[model samples]
Target: MPHPILETTDLTVRFGGHVAVDHITCNFNAGELTAIVGPNGAGKTTYFNLISGQIPVSEGRVKLNGTDITRMSVAQRTHRGIGRAFQLTNLFPNLSVLENIRLVVQSKAGRGFNILSMADSHAELTGPAYEILERIRMTDQADQVVSELSHGDQRKLEVALLIALDPLVYMFDEPTAGMSVDEAPVVLDLIAELKTRKDRAILLVEHKMDVIRTLADRIIVLHNGALAADGDPAEVMASDVVQEAYMGRDLEEALANV
Candidate 1:
């Protein structure tokens, strides 16, 4: 088998006295979308934090394409081809949508922001930014301030920013959390479009079963911060632990704690 693009070997993290993610060892390959699912506080997001360098690892190591990166900072990890979009909207509320994406493209191109001379000298930057916006179908809103966009549009823009980076691994935490039913599909479609790339590995943490069923090529379940099941989506979703720990009374109790 091909080496996994992203690998977590006995990956673990703790919050002071609490062990949030308990020794998870897994590998994610290119050309696959793996959905991470668990009840609240099951360490799904915490595990993401470990892989993306958002938090320190209490133990174990995170590797990208076989190179250990447990000590890398968040920016370093992004530079190494890991892009994550969070559950909340993370944007420059004051900047126009085009500017937001252009900044990323420019940064990726190694032309650090030129705040003093902002006279469109970088056609190379805007050209790709416009293409990203067009890919997400946000062409009409390119000039709008990010603060003025609806939650759904902002979510789409976040995905566009991730695309602008063109990371080898794409991580999303509930990409459609706040959108109206009608608006969620647009983001899902964008994700589905990314899934077609043979060089990309996608990791998603979502509670929505419909979204999981729709996009996940594989499913890995986390329970009490450990791997409960990992396999085909249909089989994993139907497994005993997922049925009991995630959907049964245990899940209700877990949700209450969260």
Candidate 2:
């Protein structure tokens, strides 16, 4: 078999004596969307942190296309093709939406020094930035300061930032956390669109079973920081292990509620 686009071997992290993310060994491949699900505090996000280099690995290694990146910094991992979107908005508050994306495009192109000061003259940066904004349907808000944008719009912009980076791995922790039902589908549609590309792997950490049911190609259950089940979305979501791991709201209840 070919190598997975991303792999974690015994990945773990400890906060003093507490093992936030226990030994989690999993492989993620391109052209797939894996939804990491478990009860709150199950360390799903911590696992993402370990893989994305937001936290150091206490005892494991993360690989991208077979390259060990366990010791790399967050920026290094991002440059190496790991793109992460937070549960909360992570953007340049003072800058316009266009400027926010333009900076990332510039950085990805190894021309971050342009720094939006001479942004108008840098078509190389703005051209791609505009394209990403258009893709996310944020072209109208291009000149609005990020701080001034609504929470839902800010969330959309964050996804746009990830798109601008164009990484091999896309990590989204509850991509629709604070958006209204009306606003959520725009982001979900974009995720659906991204999943079409065969070269990118999308990792989503979401509790909305409906979203998971609709977006996940595979579902991985994490309980107490350890991997519990991994397989087809329908099968894994119904497995005894998954039912027990998600006792807070069993699959049946989650599905019924949806």
Candidate-wise lDDT, in order: 0.87, 0.88
Residue 151 displacement (Å), model 2: 0.8
Candidate 1: regions farther than 4 A off: 113-119, 247-258
For every model shown, the clashing-pair count is 0, 0
lDDT of 2 by residue, 69-164 (tens): 999999999999999998878889999999999988988998865445666888878899999988888899999999999999998888888888
lDDT of each residue in 123-167, candidate 1, tens digit only: 889999999888888899999999999888998888788889989
Number of the top lDDT candidate: 2
TM-score of model 1 (CA atoms):
0.92
Residue 142 C-alpha lDDT in model 2: 94
